[model samples]
Target: MFGLKDLIGLIISCFIILPVVTFIRETGYFIISGLLGAKNPRLTIGSGPRFFKFKFIDIRRYYHVYSWFSFDFIKAKSKFAYISIYAGPILINAAVALVINALLANDFFEDSKTFWNRFIFYVFYFVLFDAIPMKTVNGKPNNGMIIYELLRYGKRIDYNEDPIIPGTTEAEEEYQKEVEKMKEIKWKEVEEEETFYTDKKG
Candidate 1:
């Protein structure tokens, strides 16, 4: 039966645990790609308008909903390099889950065992989805699919012109443009509302 405890757990999972796991997953990309000499890398968290940015990390308003890592270019552009980059998130999450599981088995963090268990669960959940070779709902291939294609054909099979990792500069420019458009729309709405009130008053 659903109760207050379940509700609290759900809130923690959605807000805190999930966001941390997501940040870790995206960090896998940053770490692997950085090692391979990726230039101008940026890790963007969430979607919609920007909230704030710190160094390489960009936090959006609706944080915890979505996140991605982007780089302008990679020095080592080989099939093997691409495979490693794609496999990064899967391996990283799996490693974290295993470590947590082991710690739990040894009776570590007994006081917050439930929290740690939930954390491990979400970590493995991320690993499972990332390690599976399939296209997402938007038709874009996931990391597993990309790795599989590279292993089998030694090349990306998808004819999509867009690169797997977008350029940091390009992404920022596009985001700024989106913000401007949003501001313009809001201004228009405010003007219309004011005009409507004036007419009604007169």
Candidate 2:
């Protein structure tokens, strides 16, 4: 689906995109980690030389603090927080896009196009991909849900929580019990198909 138009837009966007996203990511990590306190965090992106360096945070398991909350609450908070966190990156992108569109359309800032582009590029040099994945990864797969599973079922992982990832023997047994219990409750399906009468009716 990529064509000349897409390629052109990509090239143009690249002029404002690469550094903007990178910077936003790195700056975000630094700001969050700083707020949380202890060791400063640095994030890196792409396959090239490391731009931001990740350091071991000295804080004592602060990231796991959110586990105290319920699964529903955690999920809701994460989603809401993500939007707030990404606001800066979106704004930066919008601003750069507007500037580039204006320059390309009216040729008003022809002389400083290079200057604006360079400024945008350099400003984002500090931002990196690792910074952005902080909330996205939640440090581990189960994250806040793990605590809820433990509290509710007395196990770190619920039976159906992961259909693919196998649980311990006890959890498996518990899951089978849950399944059998659920099976006892009969559910009537909507009888739209009458298999026995269909052929005779025809």
Best by TM-score: 1
Tens digits of per-residue lDDT, candidate 2, 42-75, equal 2323322222323421212212211110011112
lDDT of 2 at 106: 81
Clashing pairs in 1: none
* Model 2 Cα shift for residue 176 (angstroms): 44
Give the per-residue lDDT of model 1 (tens digit) for 153-179: 998887766777789999999998998
Which segments of model 1 are wrong by more than 4 Å?
A: none
* TM-score of each model, in listed order: 0.95, 0.28
- Residue 123's lDDT in candidate 1: 95
Clashes per candidate (backbone, < 3 Å):
0, 3
Error of 1 at 124 (Å): 0.7
- Highest-lDDT candidate: 1
